[model samples]
Target: MGPITVTDDLARIDLDVVHRWLSTDAYWALGRSRETVEAAARGSLSFGALVRSDDGDELVGYARVVTDRATFAWLCDVYVAPSARGRGVGSALVRAVLEALEPMGLSRVMLATHDAHALYRRHGFGEPAHPEWLMALQPTPAASPATPAV
Candidate 1:
């Protein structure tokens, strides 16, 4: 994880890299337009992980929280670039987001994951006690502009 840094500064995020990952590599948000992504970024609390190299710091991981910053937060769009994986980038990004939210007085933070349950589990996220009450207004696949992949 050498020289990797996590920050909540939206200005520090590299939109091109983030848009590329979400639009192509990431299972979620595939084929999402750059404009849509930029809009989403502006509406969310953004976190980015960067790896410092001779070329300077490159954005390698990202996560965002959609919240009113009062009572609830939904963590989404967590992704790490392929070249930056296996170096704890994902962990760093998640932890950073959590830390940033610590002072917001939020009562709950939620996220949905298909296969990375273990990663989130280590961060204190667990199965909801009232799973039966959880519901979504998810649009049909064709109707939705964004979809969750892996």
Candidate 2:
């Protein structure tokens, strides 16, 4: 809510804070490591941003944009720490990613958010008009087991 710092440089991020945030954020599947985020940030040809909270030097949220820089972009891995919700952190992260990609000449950009529809909408994202036009092939399922230990 107060002044927060947002940066495009992942190299300057404190990965330990990010690792802790991902570990506790329910909207994000647990299992991310600082190494993975660092790798993606280094390897991604598109855009990414790490959001940090002003209060405690914590990494509160993150998002990445995957794009071809031609006609399309897909935003993914939107995460906001539970302690960091309701503070515009999520929306701020999304907006920063979108702004980064605006110059890429993309005809359309998209992402899927289950319960945060309003947050994305506030950033000019809308539901896909053709539900029939969208389908995803996971390529490979997430390595996590289908059934959790019980």
Pick the TM-score winner: 1
lDDT of each: 0.77, 0.59
Q: After superposition, how far is residue 44 of candidate 1 from its true place, in Å?
A: 0.7
Model 2: how far is 85 from its true place, Å?
1.0
For candidate 1, write residues 5-119 as lDDT tens digits: 9988989999888999999977778999999889999999889999887788889899988999887788899998888777889899888887888778666677876656667
Clashing pairs in 1: 27-149, 28-149
- Provide the lowest-lDDT 10-residue window in model 1: 133-142
Model 2 — which ten-residue stretch has the worst lDDT?
134-143
Predicted structure 2, TM vs. truth: 0.67
Q: How large an RMSD does model 2 have?
A: 10.6
Give each model a TM-score.
0.83, 0.67
RMSD of each: 9.3, 10.6
Using lDDT as the measure, which candidate wins? 1
- Per-candidate count of clashing residue pairs (backbone under 3 Å): 2, 0
- The residue pairs found clashing in candidate 2 are none
